[model samples]
Target: MNRIMRESRKLRSWEEMKKIILQRGSSGKDVLAPIDEVFGRKFSVIVDEMPPYISLRNGFTGYIADIWQIISSELNVSAEFQKHSFDAGKELIKNGSVDLLITPVIITTTDIDEIDFSIPIVKIWYELFMKSSDDGATSMSYIVTWSRNLWFAFLLTICILTATLWIIVNIRLRLERNRGKTPPAWQTRLDFWRGYRRWAKGPEPENTLKNELVSVSSVGSSFLFVLGALTNQGNCLKLNSPSIRTATLVTLFFGLLMYNAYSSVLISRLAVGRTTLPFPSLESVAEAKTHIICVRRYSFAYVQFKQREEDKELLEKWQGLVNEPPCLNTTSVRDVAAALCYDNTLILETPNIVAKIIEDYNRSNGCDITRLYGHYARATATVLMKKHFRYRHHFNKMYYFFFYFFSFFSMMINAMLHGGKNFERGTRS
Candidate 1:
């Protein structure tokens, strides 16, 4: 009974000391001395494999690991890293089984209350990843060169010009008739017969003023004339009215402009070999009912999608597709890539991570995957630690220091390279 009482008292005293150390640490005092005496010089870190940020390749090496290394060396402490799934890592941190999680954790409202996050080390945005289409520049390239609205406007312009020309010619004909001008002699039946009898020996009588006026006054003839001018194929019909002549010239100029623009765009598309995607954008993806594959349930991408009120319909569609058979909740990058290449699916992830995956995959397999659509959502990523960690402030400071250092170093290197190129050019000149 006496021994039990003594042990309990010692435990109570140790707890009190830890509380005091935590208070000092929270108050911005140097509490490392107490932490060292009580906890030890080593920490246990848990991490998930997120490429370009925290990867397990070559035994735990990446941006976050490097930062952690710098901080640990500065503080003269050591860490033991263990690989685990993101969910498992979070559970460990919450239960006080781990000191830190070094994966690139996107900051979300739901996680703020459970775990603490360090200063943002990187900015990340979600993008769509899918397999590149095998067919490049499909048969519909010419038709798709101009948008539907542009085509509609072009057709409407043609109709308007045709109507204008027809109205102007009819008004001129009416005025001439009102002025008591008689039709040409060739318009009479006997004269027409005589002209047809002489057609083989002389110029055709259809070119006479009466036939020209008749053709111009007809709506179908006006439409054909306008279309021919637009296509750079001028008609043979003669127009005497100044207004009709002006409208024809305008149609010709507009046709030339539209033709040049269309030709330039088509040539570029064919030259660059732009692969047409099945669904060009997120809205189209939803409309096409393409399944979305994400790393895990409630992942950052999923969370962002859910929180966006504007994409409510998209969110519902995603939920419905994800709940179907052939589950897409995969953690392996290779599996995600395979699913994208094989199935009609799209994966959502950060640009850098997707690029890394493509680079690595292309090294082994052929180039098959590609990034589609633009960024979907932007978020800042940081390392997650246990709530109220004693070394949180210290880690944040060191991380910021190293981040700035590397950025400055990269800028200097680029400047030096550019200066060298300029100097070489001057010397050559």
Candidate 2:
């Protein structure tokens, strides 16, 4: 009788639990039910050797691995990570052979229909990387020492000075001729007007205004004098008028200041060994038909180049160059770095990934890589899963909760440390 009572009680307890579960399910309040269904199940995770995201060092360790650990722990699921290239991993996921892909998969329009992505874990942008070369002090350096506006101002000053000198000399000569004084030996010489007379006189009289007025040769001589002063090359022209002497003095001083400044800057630049990039902008890179444009195969960089509409012609040109001889399809960061270092290649990758590559490769290869300043493309990276993943909602929910919690925690720690340092500094002061 006691055994029958115990059996009845056990049946009642099971029935009550079943009724509770049914009610929760009907009301859509059983959030953990799906999780419970898949609890303790092992999932096959596909991963690639993407550093700081999914690395093989020490066996399945990186920021993405950490996130997976948190999500899997909350869901009570185990993951068996399999190493493969990003392309191979996508293939495996498509075939339903892998439950998840944990690399830093960038969300792009091209692949959105083919796969499902979790909430974005990180934002990234594409930057250009190229080999650093020491072609120091290029021929254009002297011209670039002064900006276009400055150079324009300098030329204007020269023209103004030349006109002033020419006018003063002409006025002085007119005064002397009016006083009935004989022309100076230098002034009487025909060489000053020789070319002008031949071009303008043909057979005209000598006393014509065109002849008596300052010859075109005088204008040329004035220009040459001003240019020579600015360049610190003294001229042999003689001036007698006080006004002409005063103008010459001003020109000499202006030239002195400009010449000194230009020389100092040029010398410092040459001494410092400043280097300039052959392709400084995206437009320049596109125009460079001889150089190869390299990017990881099947990466977002490749997708961006093909899909960008603003520079369609440039993209087409880049594609054509990439398809040509000696252009490599880089598959990894290391490969990109190697191409940048050895080949005439321009690599497109995210700033952080490029940083990692440069940091690793520059140490051994002597700092042969550099990243361009501005980014041309942007993307968000997320974990990839098979389309119609059953546990996606739960996984995303837990992932977001943990991610924000940890982010908040880190911010607080940083604030506290920064406040303490400020307090210490105040006390010291």
Candidate 3:
């Protein structure tokens, strides 16, 4: 009872708590030395299997390691940072095996319940990377151009509808019993529109000629609407501007809209049954499940890879090749390559170590294990804490501070790295 009271009292003061923790060997300080030396006792930290940590030569070796050394020296503590798989890291913290967690720690409530954390030492950004050999970088402009293939798709839909409608109209005119009686073209157009409206708003499936004609006419309406919206000609008075040039621009916009609408229909008809970009064939061990490595139950590229039905089918098809995804050999990215079995050639990995990996491989000119498909999922890193830690306030302050600093730098650095005069010089084919 007295010991319990003493422990309660110890937590009341920050210095007393620190002194008590030091005696127990847990230092909340971010440092390089063993935990005992830093806290004046003994302590352990749970870290994810990320490289340059402590196990390998390149493990957390360069600038980051140096920074940790500075922090270690300043705090005068010996800290033992242990590496584990992502899930294992959580388990270690939950089981009270570690006093703190510090590898690219993402702060969250669940994490706080398992382990304590010091001030966030660094910020990590997750990004998508593709092969550099593919001259086009993955950027907003690239995505727009690639997927604006939507315009072509829409145009195709219009063509099929228009042709179907014309055939039906001509057939009905020929079937008319009285040769002298004929519906005007505009009347026929209005009838098509009415049929279209009914077909769209009516039952689940409409199979009659009227429904088919309606569907065709609706397609035309959609083409015109998209064209008008894209060119900003559908709303002229709303775009009223003072400059005489503005009126001229508006007229030009209307002209462009008409051209685009006509051309879209024409192209859709011509390009029927064809696509410019072929579905990349599934070849090589990397494309097969035999060589792909992902952490157990931990989603890496799983979601993104699954999104492509073809990729998912291939994975299922080749699942026989991979008996099981090997336990991630090490958390550090550099060591990760060596752990891959000869049969395994691909590691579904995080987006954050891309630049370093690229630099390393370029410098080595060896086997390449560093290409990414697309973004999988987004999840923030959080620290795990034991129930008694009671250090939520400390972790939150550190997280917010680290988040602000890194986010600012990430934006600035990303812009600088991905954009320049050279980036702007490219022309679309």
The lDDT leader among the candidates is 2
Regions of candidate 3 where Cα sits further than 4 Å from its true position: 1-49, 52-97, 105-346, 361-373, 390-392, 402-429
Candidate 1 per-residue lDDT over residues 1-429, each given as its tens digit: 223222223332433333333333334355454435323378888878767777777877777677666556655678898889777888888887888887775546666777988888777678777666653577888787777899999899989988988888787777655544444775756577665676658653343444467656888988898878777787645666677678777878887888788889998988876666566666676677766555434346656446463343436656665423343456555555545554565777777777777666543434566667677766576878898888777766656555644543432343344544443343345
Please list the residue runs of candidate 1 whose C-alpha ends up more than 4 Å from where it truly belongs after superposition. 1-42, 66-78, 106-114, 179-211, 276-284, 290-295, 304-316, 323-328, 362-367, 400-429
Best by TM-score: 1
lDDT of 2 by residue, 257-358 (tens): 999999998888778765555666667877866577777755666655664523324355566665244445567766766666645667777877776666
Judged by whole-model lDDT over C-alpha atoms, candidate 3 comes out at: 0.43
Q: Give the candidate order by descending lDDT.
A: 2, 1, 3
lDDT, residue 229, candidate 2: 88
Every model's TM-score:
0.70, 0.62, 0.36
Each candidate: how many clashes? 0, 0, 34
lDDT of each: 0.65, 0.66, 0.43
Model 2 misplaced regions, further than 4 Å: 1-43, 59-78, 105-110, 137-140, 143-157, 160-225, 228-268, 307-316, 361-367, 391-429
lDDT tens digits, residue span 34-96, model 3:
232333433575555443332234454543445445434434545687767656777777787
TM match of model 1 to true structure: 0.70
Rank list by TM-score: 1, 2, 3
